[model samples]
Structure formats: C-alpha cells, structure tokens
Target chain A: MSTPFIITKASGESETFSLEKLRHSLLKSGASPETTEDIIEELERDFYSGMRSRTLYKKAFSLLRRRYKAQAARYQLKKAIMELGPSGYPFENFVGEIFKAQGYTVEVGVILQGHCVRHEVDVVAENETERILVECKYRNTPGFKCDVKIPLYVHSRFQDIEKEWRKLPGNHHKKIQGWVATNARFSGDAIQYGECVGLQLLGWDYPQSRSLRKWIDEDRLYPLTALTTLSKSEKQRLLEKDYILASELVSSPHCLEILNLTARRKHQIQNEVRQLCGNGD
Target chain B: MSTPFIITKASGESETFSLEKLRHSLLKSGASPETTEDIIEELERDFYSGMRSRTLYKKAFSLLRRRYKAQAARYQLKKAIMELGPSGYPFENFVGEIFKAQGYTVEVGVILQGHCVRHEVDVVAENETERILVECKYRNTPGFKCDVKIPLYVHSRFQDIEKEWRKLPGNHHKKIQGWVATNARFSGDAIQYGECVGLQLLGWDYPQSRSLRKWIDEDRLYPLTALTTLSKSEKQRLLEKDYILASELVSSPHCLEILNLTARRKHQIQNEVRQLCGNGD
Candidate 1:
C-alpha cells in the first residue's frame, strides 16, 4: 500500500500526502488534532525540508503543551475548594484561586532554583508594591495535629527561595515576603519553626473574612474568576489520590482481553487488579 | 500502644520499646526473628520525638532508592541479551536507561513533554568530548512496526539537544549523537527518522558467538548478576508479560504474592509444576 502521506515516490511525478491527510492520522492516534493542524500550517510555511531540523517542531509542541497546561490551571483554580494537603498542582491552584477570589494577580508554579532553581513556591501574588509568596498545603485530613516534617521541609524550601530573592535582579529583592497556607491546622512546633524563620504561617484559620483590603486597594490581588469547571466528582477524586496515575485506563480491546484472561488466573489477576487500582504496595 | 522506638512521652521521661517486648509484636505481624532485628535497628535510627521531623529519614530513604536504582540498572544490564533491541527496556525506558547506562546521569523525564511521559527518553551520557543521548523503548511485541513514534520523537529530541548543545557555556561545543534501543524493532518511518537524525539504531538481533565476545570485551554491556536479586520464580512471573518486565519488577512481598496467586490460578493443582518453568513471553 502507498504511504498515507503523499510525497513524490522515487519515480518522481509530483505527488504528496496532503497536509490534511497527515492531520487525520494524528487525530486517529489520539494526538491533539488542532495541534497537528497548527503545526502542519507552521511547518508548511517554513518547509525548507531539512534546513532547520527538529528544534522547530519541538518548540511548536512545547508551546502547545504549555498553553494546554496554563489553561487547565486557570480552569482548575475557579472550581477549587478548601483543598486539604493536596498534591503540588492542586495546592498551588488553591492558593491562586483564593487570591483570585480576593482580587490578586497570581502566578503559580514558577521555577526558581538556586539563584535559578532554588525553591518553587506554590503561588506568588503581586499587586503594585508588595509581592506575596503563598505556600499552600492541601491535606486529605484537616486536623491541628499536623506533621512537623511537612512544615520544616516547606520552611527549608522557603529559605532557599528567600536566599534567591535576595539576589533578584531588580526591585523584587525588597518586595517579597513568604506566607504558608494549609488546610490543616499547624502544630505549635510548626508555628515556632515559621516564627523562627520569620515566615508568616496561615493554617485553616487565615483571616479569610477581612478580604485583604490592603491587597485589593493596592491591586496586590486581581479579581480572577474562581474555577467553575471542576465537577464535585473530580474534586472528590482528587482528594482521594495522593499521586497521579501516568496512564489512563486503557479500554482498548487488547486491554480488555488481557484483563479478562488475567482475572481468571487468580494470582496474576490480583496483581493486575492491584495495579489497575493504583495500589503499588 | 507504645511506639516502636524510644519515645519520651508527653510526661518527658526516657522511655523505650525494648527488643524483647517488641519481639512478640513483630512475630504476630509475620516478620521473621532476623527481620525483627533489622526493623528495630532501622526504627531506632529513624525515631525522634518532640514533633518528629521525617525529612532526614525521607532523605535517607531517597538515598537508598537512588543506590538501589543504580544497582538495579547494573543488574538489568548484565541480564540484557546481546541482541535484544537497545537492551529491551520497555518502549518508554529506552532513552532514559540508555542515558543512564552510558552515564549521562541527568534526568530526561524533566524535559519530556507528551502524553506518554511515563515512556520517556531522558538519559544523556556526557563527558568532555562526546555526549550520547540514549533513548530506550521497551515493547511487549518483538517487531519494530508498532513502535516508531518514540524513536521519531526521540530523534526530534536529539535535534533539540544538538541545538541546545551549541548554546552551552565554555569551550565545550561537543556534538550529541542519539541511540535508540527497544525490545521491539523499528517501524520503517522510525528507522528513517533515526537515519535522518544520525541516531545509532540498536535493534534486536541475538548475538552470535563472536558478537558476545566483542560485547564483553568492549565493556559496553552490563552483567546480569549485578542487575537483580530476584528469585527464579519472580523472574519467570515478570518475564511472562513482557520479557522486558524482568527489569522492571521489584522483588517484594507483594510481587511474590502476585506470583503465587498467578500460578495457583493458572493450574488448579493439576500435575506438579516447577515454580520457575514458563516460556519467556
């Protein structure tokens, strides 16, 4: 059979796999269909064969992924609830969502390493003069008997961030202060740790009633819509799992057959079932 | 119940969970007597009071994990069939493992942007003169037909790596070549892509007597003895799904339990069966 993408076969008569055909195949394989179209359009515009190699396509895909991720983050923030020790993403979302509700422009999950890769604070809120680094912890259980380990770790990471901020290129060196937020109440030791480190600690009892009037007036917080897309079911599901499963449930016929056969073979089936259910233990 | 290690209770007196007292509890939990001693020692090292911090312990655990991973990689290499495609890791393991195998010692997963992040090519073997970008692909199938996307993507990544390599600091403007080894063979397009990008393609070809000797002499291969400590039964169970799974299976009680269940379910007490007898999948 002729290859789907039409190109002049060695016999050399002007033939080509229509860009449209390439897109169709990518969609069939579960690729982001729109991505293929846009990429094809861009590639066609710059199609000098092998002049500029793979970096061009890599950049295109990277842009697409970043766009998708940013949009998802925004959508999630609007619908987030009082997330308890949530994983990295949800915790950041909660912090940004809270700030948005109170009218603050917030950026979540920015990488700041040692000077460049130091600490990755969950959320950073900026108004005009002041910048707030909000570290959010989403816990499954909400209790005051919090683990000292989590806060201490958070504190160490914060210290690293502070050290980096001290070296910020511009005026940011003076505008930033760190704050920690958690769904669960903090232990006294954690508060002591925060106090010792000169960081603000905001547990479940952060003064949510005041609405951060200073933040609003100074435009420290911008009013962004709370994430409205999160379904209650999705939120509940998020609360239940500590980790994300890399693979989606494969509902293909092959998977079904394997599951059926393995299920019948008790020992292997048990292992398979456990894996399917995410019980690595 | 008293904690496993010494805990100065709320009253603040020196208290200890003695070995003799803990022995009964350990036995009840099905731990062997020898295992109990190991457990107590570990618990003693890990235990702390006054709002215990687990970060240090976690760091220790993480260190152990890294050491175990390095050891595991060595073992897997030893068992690697000389002709197995790129060392027969799963399609996903291709790049990362090869990079690890070659000592790029950097994480490739961090740069991967795709749906199959679990299947990543993230290892780069780097030195002053040359850098080999190793992308591993482990497949259940034995042909290269179904597994071209990865090599294609990896070839694309290599192009990106080359572009980035030019921008690196100092006088180190070295070229980074790519190698892709998969348990499966390459599809026509994958091979074409590899060729287009100058990737060294390692496909599955059983080593002839002469080839084995060559591999041993080059010191480019891993020895099987150092790859794993799994029992024969465990190895058989893992190899059944994808022969590549032999490298992925971690020996633990859970894995053993799964194996036991699988065997019992496969043959309901028929004729006597050897524990490790099965054709490698």
Candidate 2:
C-alpha cells in the first residue's frame, strides 16, 4: 500500500526498487531459501528513498560473504568481472576464452588489413564454415552502456574488413559476421542500429537467453578474479600473465607459481576454484 | 643535412623538421620576413633530434610575441581554438557561425528525430539547395586527430536523419550532406572513409585551400579567445556568455559591458578586436 522506495542506478537514473528482482538474484546465486528470506528481511530495514543500488549491492555482498564464501563470490559475478579492468585487454581475452570454449579457434588481438586501412581487431573467431570478427567494448564502471555510435563505427570497420576478406582465394564461400560484445548493456538506439545493420550485439544481459552472463555460467568459464581466496593484486597479476579464466588454471596449474603463495594458500585457492567451476576433486 | 633533425609531432609520429615549413607558417601569420628569419635562427640553435615540435612552436611564439602582439595572436590561432574547450559546446557554436557566414541558416545543438531514434546533432545548416549536418569534434589536446570511427559513426547518424528528412515535404530536391569538422587534423583512414562515403571532412588544415583556419581568416571570424588584449578569464567569461566570435563584439559592444571593465580598458579591447577583424577605426 505504501510507495516503493526509489533507488539510483549506476547510470544516474532512478527506478523503483523491486523486492522480487532482488529475491530472484539471491536465489540465482545459490543462496538457501531461509538465508535469502533472512537477507531480504535485513535489507528491508535499511531500505530508504533515493538509496544507491551500488550501496545496496555492497551491503548484500558483505552479508553473504559472512555466511558463505563461494556463494558470495557467485553473487558478485558482475562486480568481479568489472574488477578485471582499468584496461580492456583482460576482458578481451576473457571474451576470446568464451568463444574458444564453444569450439571456435580464437585470436585475442590481431591486426587485419582492411580495404582502406589496417584495423586492430579485438577478437577473431573461426569455425569450419564461419568467421566472426568481434569488437569487445569493456567498461569498468557499472551502468555505462555501449551507445549507437559504437555499433555504427564497428559496422563500417566490418564492411572494410569484409571487403578485403572476400578477395582471398578461399573466403568467398565462407560466412563473415561482425559481433560487438561488451561487459555493459546496450542503449536502445545501439541495439536498434546493430540489429538493423546485422551486427550481432552481445551485452551483459542482452538477448536474454544467451548473453555474456549466461554464456559464462553455462560454459563454467568463470574469470580467475571470481576466486574469493585470491587478493585483488593476485588476480591482476594473473590477468597480466594472460591467465584469464579459472578453468585456465585447471589446465595450466603452473600459472599459480607466479603468485608465490604458500603451499597451504595455493591449495585453498585451487580448492575454491575447482568447486566454483563445478569440477569435483 | 644531419639526419634532418627529427622532431616529434603531437600525434606521436616523428618527422624531419623542415625549415621551409616553419618559415611558411610564420609568413602566413603576417610576420615580416626579417622577423621570421630572426625567430627561425633562434629556433635552430635549440633544435635537436627527438625534440618535440610543441617546444619548437613555443620558442617561435614567444619570440614573435616580443616583437608583435596581433601577429602573435594570429600565429597562435590553432592553440587559441583549442583553448575554447574542455567541453565542446563553444566549438559547436563556432562551427555553426562558420556555416552562417556562408549565408546558411544554422542551428547549433538541435535534437532531430531519426528513423528509429532521436539524435542531438551538433550543428544543422540549411540553404536553398543543401541541408548539412555537422558533427564538431573538438579536442583540447594539441595532437589528437579525429579518426575513422568518427566519420563512420557520423555517416550512420546522417543516414538515419536523411531518411527521415526525405519523408518530409520539399526535401527530395535538396542535397543532404554529413560533415565532420574538427579543430585538429584527421587521420588518413578517417579521410579515406569520409571521402568514400561522401561525408565532408573539414579539419584545421585539411583540403589545403579551404580548411577551418582558411575559412576563419578569410571571413575574419577569429574567436574571442584569440584576442591577446583580454586576459584568459575575460576571454572565458565572454565565451561563457556565447560571445565566441570577435566580430560579435563589433556588432554588440554591450557584451564587453558584462566584464565590468574600466572605460579605458574596454576601449583597449575594442581597438584590438577592430584591428584583428579589420574594422579599422
């Protein structure tokens, strides 16, 4: 019967806070029904008009971390991804790994000759019948949406590259597609222009059923930064060394050697990584 | 003769510094041949391999300022244009004024409905036979160039607007054009793409015969910031009140009244403005 509390989003827009959305997200993070209800009750006491969504998220994350480490890590997947940057290279590699898991041969950064000029493409993925060029737009700040200008510029780049590609001996019969993948949402105009031009846009929660979040979760390809046991600097070190995915550490255990953690600490992190990745020891 | 004294450009490229180029620019700024020779000689003594061109420019500007006031202001036209912003609104207005000088009805910062969405266009100019949309890209930094992405994006926006414009009555007969104007230079790829797509590109010194600088000098449309008689804060105050052009003051002397200057001080600025604009008293 009362007016719903208004919350400020990262994009500086205000919206009425929905209890159902919060409850659904908590359950999605593997929180128990009782724990989810308890957290909801606790959060209700702190709810006020004009509260920032970021503050609300932090409060929930800290509360969850006290009860369950792995669940808390899972709950903060979006934030953890943002922590991978200040630079965009690591996010590009993370996107490449996602495509790699889908059985595509991926190159993270490569320079390709366009008809007019040379372009440094973010990710190039290839399969038997198709080649995909992806421009990964990474934003460390939450609520920064990729605008229409991004896809508009990207479409032109694709056109140039596609023209050069068709001239190669074996490329005429292959399908060449352009994709724009971002760690943020797409503006309505951006999505409209992208769809109109046939440039596949994959954002954080766009295309609802098969977004970046869904792909990461479905493939069990969590970023190394998702490990709660590792410190922020440790995650940055691994990212700098081109170790982006936690699943990467499973294959190349030697990557941990660079961190120089004690044997006990290393085992703890490895155990957390394995469990979070759904790989049973 | 000694490896041509490589000087670094603002865009981070190194090129052989040409004495002829320096002489040409100084002469273009209305410097006497004797003064130009003296300044060039002073600069040569300080020239070294790997020295920044910015340092070379400062040396010449300082030497010129000592000898001539108005000519030095003309010499630093490019820098004065850059001082117009940290924001791009004033630059947009300046660009609008350029089109207005050509007898086109110009609007700055107008929102137009596109085929799918709305766009906040920087400048819109309409003449009897032509309607042009200009995107003013202003960079406060010395060496930043408008790249291909800019024109590519502007082309898409223009396409959307042009489509909508065609649906309106009496628009089909007019030639619709998109322009990317910048106070700096354009990258080679940007020029190539813009030319390929029929988008007009106007940069600081592009097209050689009719660049932004040439247009300003030809029309005597120097920005108020170019007046050395006014202090930086006074120039900023004028810009804040939309007094972008020095000619604006000649038409409406009351704009200077806003600065609360002494009668003598006001006369000093008015005299300088008239001299720069060739409105000889």
Candidate 3:
C-alpha cells in the first residue's frame, strides 16, 4: 500500500486521494486488471504528496490515453455529451417524442390563438382524452432547474389561450390542458407551483419512471445528438432532414445514401442501431 | 381504407405499401395519432395512383419535416449510427469492458510470443481459472459475416503462442486458451470450425445471454456513440481521454472542464449520464 496523498478537489477543499478508487474506476472502464495495476503503480510512482486532484486526474487520464486509447474513450462519456447542445431543436424533438409515446399528438413550435394575443407554443399535444399545450423548454447545460417564474409565466400564458380558445368549440383546441416540460428537472418551487396550479410537468427525472428519460429509453428514442459518431455538419444534415433520434435510422437508413459514407460504415451504424433499438421493447 | 400503393423491394420485386404500417411506425416514433392521421391523409390526398413507396416515404418525411422537425429527427436514427464506426477501438474497448465485468483481467491489442513467432492479440484476458488470448474483430458494415477462416487463423495464432508460452514460468500469462470475438455474427462454417476446434467465440448475439450486447446492457455499459448529443471531436477528445462509456460520465463529470462547455451543457450531460446509468441494476 502507498502512503495517502492529499488531493485538492475542484471544490477547493482538500481530501485524501484513494488509490483504490482510481483502480476501481479504471477497472470499471474495462481495463485489464494488469493494465489497471500498471497505470496505478506508475501514477503512484510519480505522484507527489500534495497534488491537486485536477492535476492527478489529468495525469492519470493522460497515462490512460497513452497506454489504452480505447479504454479511455469508454470512460469519458459525460464529457463527450457536452459537445451536443441540448438547448436546441434536437432536445425539443426528443421531448416531443416522449409525449408522443404517451399517446399525445405532439407538435413543436405550434402557434395557438389566445383571447388577447397570439402565443407561440413550444409543443401542442392532442389526443382523444385531452389536449395539452406544452412549453418545450430545452437546456444545453445540465443542473438548470426550471424555476417558479417559468411556471408562473406559462401558467398565465396557458390561461390566456384558454380564455379565448375555450370560447369556441372547434378552434385549434376544443378543451385543452397545460404542461411545462423540460429535458432538465424543475426546481422545488416550480414543482410546487405547477402542482398547486394543477399544471402538469415532465422532465428527465421529474416523475420517476414516468419521466421524459424513461419514455425515451423505453422506446429507445435516443436523439441524434446523443450519438458520438456524427460530425457537426453531418448532424446538421440529419437534423435538416428531420432525423432526430438514432432509432430513426431504423426506418430511413437509406438517408445515409446522401452522406459520403462507406458501405461498411453504413452497415456498422445499421447494426449498432439494430443492436440498440432494432428490436421492439 | 386508403388505396394501396406500390413499393419496390430491393429484391427487384414490387409490393403493396401498407398505410397501417406507416401509421404504426410514425405513431411508434411518438407522433400523435391525430398528427399521424393528418399526415397520412395529406399523403393520401396527394397520392398518385401508382407512386413508388420511396416517393411516398419521401413525401411523408417532407411533410413531417415541415410540420414537426422534432418528430422527423426521431425517425432518422438509423442514418445517424453510420456516423459512428462500431467496428473499431471504441467498440473493442466496449467489448473489453464487458469481459472485465465477467471477472477477467483484460488487455487490448496485446502481443504474445508464439512457437514459431510472435502474434498480436486483440484482447488477452485471465482470471483464477483461465488465461485466454482473444482476437477482436469488428466490422463497420453489416452483412459481413466472420467466416471459418477467421477462427482458423486465430486458432493457429493462439496455438503458436501457446506452444511457446506454455513452457514459461509465469510470464504475463500462464497456460493459455484462444477466443475470437467479433461485433458481427459468425458464419455457419465459422461457428462450426470454432466449436470443432475448441476455440471460444463471442459476438453481438452469438451466445445468447453471454453475448457481448447482452453483457453491455446487463451492466448498462452502453457505448458513448449511442448518445446523439456528442460531436465528432468532442467524442474524440473524450475517447482520447479514455471516456467511452456513458456510465463513466456519472462519476466524474468535471472531466468536461477541458472542453469549452457551458454550465448548463455540463449539467445536462451529467443528468443524462445519471439517467442512462445512475441506478445500478
């Protein structure tokens, strides 16, 4: 066993670095135990007593990069996601897909007429049971909670449309409800306000298994932005073609005919899609 | 019922297009039943008596794009996977991770000394029971089966190494075994040859519950390429840093600090990682 070393965390507080944790993370990444041990041994050999964890992490990562590029790639998924922007059309489509899965006829960027004004609804979903005017809020970065003010604004906006649209039996909606949805979670106050006002809220984990993430995974409706293999312009082209989810490849894989991809590349992706979402759950 | 349309099959045969299938697929993609009906109706209204299924698919996709870009994106997932090359290092890393979970100490792209010469091994794994040399074969395109020649070559290679290394007193590996793995399925003769020669084989679906995909899903060790949100370079950078699995992001999301991402973006990825792999099964 190596002596304990103090590591300055990103939080500015210092904590003792555990070689065991590093080894565990490495093993979790699929590195052979020998490779994991070798990397740890090397890291310990050069490690100083009072290094910042950031530097330690970087060194270990750098060492892993040099020894096994493939293993390193498997461990850095969260960082890879930062490359995909969630506050965009892709996420809105992702959210819309979930609502659709729950049996809602959903549309993004819909326009609904209010009593006193015209409101641009993020999503408007309709079904035999009820019609829901949804606010499709997308966030690129994580940790942003949909706050109370948003619910307050959307609540008023729904009322504005409800006040005017409710007058007519068959305008855009006969009788509709209101929902505020996000790929991120809602704040405590926002949830309170939404529940208090009888407004429905949906998010990644807002309602547990009934949340947005659950629906997407349940149907394997992963967004195009979630795929790590696409280039920016390639993703743009797919998006331009309205191909949002990786499962979309399920039906329209021929869409790749337009892109300059090798047959083997196409086959690999198709196989991956089949592997990921080819079969029905 | 709408009039049936003609669709040209790839086999050079024509078939009648089922509107119901289209409706089911669209609805499965999270399109509301009404929107699905409306789109089907419009496509039907513009229906030429003998339009190709391809033409009809294009028309429906175009309309869906115009009306619901989000929904369109959801339908385009297959094409997206081509953007990801599944027959490569990341995938090999993915495979290695699964084996690691199965209690193997693994190494990718290893070299072993043979009776006559030295051979490069795709993966070298060991535990208390067996020391196995593996050949990781990945194919980007579908329909390319691993033929008998693959296992033959791998068996020969393993036997060569075994002849020399078996006499060693605890080199990196003691007495060794041979296994050939591919992401694609094996040919009939290939499986026959592997079984006859006593060589182990693994693929996406080769051995049922012990298949590579089954193992990945059982552990929730999904490839980051499955995420639609990451860009090419971002995935590369993360891969370079050894971050390839979505689950890895759950523990050390601050790894994104090197990338120029917003706070919200980081948070979204963290949330997604948690959603994908947070609750351990």
lDDT-superior candidate, 1 or 2? 2
Q: lDDT per residue, candidate 2, B1-281, as tens digits? A: 23468889999999988878888989998888998998887777777788899889888877776557666677888988988998999999999998998999999999998886688899999999999999999999999989888987898788888888899998889999999999999999899888877899999999789999999988889999998888999989999998899878778999988899998988888777777888321
Docking class of 3: incorrect
- Where model 3 places Cα greater than 4 Å from the true spot, the runs are A1-87, A170-175, A278-281, B1-281
Model 1 chain A poorest ten-residue lDDT run: A243-252
Please report, in order, the local distance difference test score of every candidate based on alpha carbons.
Answer: 0.46, 0.87, 0.68
Kindly indicate the candidate among 2 and 3 with the higher TM-score.
Answer: 2
lDDT tens digits, residues A10-56, model 2? 99999988878877888898888888887777777787778899888
Residue B267 of model 1 has an lDDT of 40
Best by DockQ: 2
Native-to-model Cα distance after best TM-score fit, residue B27 in candidate 2, in Å: 18
| lDDT by residue for model 1 (B1-281), tens | 23545544445555554547555655565656665555555555555654222333343344344444543443444244332333343333333443454455545433533221122344556677677766655554334343434553455445444555566586256656777654445666555545554667765432233232233323333322223344554444444433332223322224335556555443421110111111110
Evaluated on CA atoms against the true complex, candidate 2 attains a DockQ of 0.30
Docking class of 1: incorrect
What tens digits encode model 3's per-residue C-alpha lDDT throughout B29-57?
A: 77788888888888776776556677787
Better of 1 and 2 by DockQ: 2
Clashing pairs for model 2 are none
Q: Could you give the TM-score of chain B for each candidate, in order? A: 0.39, 0.76, 0.67
